[model samples]
Target: MSKKEKFEELLKRLQEISEQLESEDLGLDKAVKLYEEGIKLSKLCHQKLEAAELKINELKSDVTAK
Candidate 1:
């Protein structure tokens, strides 16, 4: 799959994690596990976005230089 597809999948999982975290009756251990997973997903998403942004900026600069 492409980076965009992977990023979209990660974003969807992050939203799922958020919903799970917000549940009223979740067990402490399960919540903690989900929270850790969510943190990993969040970091991955941030990295993906930062990489995409840098690539876009580089493309813009290249176009300007041409």
Candidate 2:
């Protein structure tokens, strides 16, 4: 799969985990595991966002240079 596909899958899993955690029936251990996964997902998502921001900044710089 492509990087975009992996990112999208991670995002979907994050959303599912978020919803599951919202439920009161989740066990403590399971919640901890989900929280770890969520932290990983959040970091990956932040990295992607930062990359996109950098790309946008590059494009803006090019536009200004022209």
Candidate 3:
């Protein structure tokens, strides 16, 4: 999958994780696993945001150069 597609999928996973975390009856082990997944998702989201920022900067430069 492309970086963009992966990023979108990660976002959906993050939302699922969030919903799972919100449930009051989650077991400790499952909660820990979900927390770890959430951390991974957060990192991926940050990386995607940075990549998008870089792309926007590149586009701005290209527009200015034209």
Between candidates 1 and 3, the TM-score winner: 1
**What lDDT tens digits, residue by residue, belong to model 1 across residues 1-66?**
335457778889999999999999999999999999999989888877666643333333556666
Stronger candidate by lDDT (1 vs 3): 1
What TM-score fits each model? 0.70, 0.66, 0.67
Number of the predicted model whose lDDT against the real structure is largest? 1
Q: Once superposed on the true structure, which residue ranges of model 1 sit more than 4 Å away at CA?
A: 1-5, 53-66
Alpha-carbon runs more than 4 Å astray in model 2 = 1-5, 53-66
Among all windows of ten consecutive residues in candidate 2, which has the lowest summed lDDT? 53-62
Cα displacement (Å) at residue 25, model 1 = 1.3
> What is the C-alpha local distance difference test score of candidate 1?
0.83
TM-score of model number 3: 0.67
Question: What would you estimate as the lDDT of candidate 3?
Answer: 0.82
**Alpha-carbon lDDT, every model:** 0.83, 0.82, 0.82
Clash count for candidate 1 is 0
Candidate 3 lDDT for residue 38: 99
Number of the predicted model whose TM-score against the real structure is largest = 1
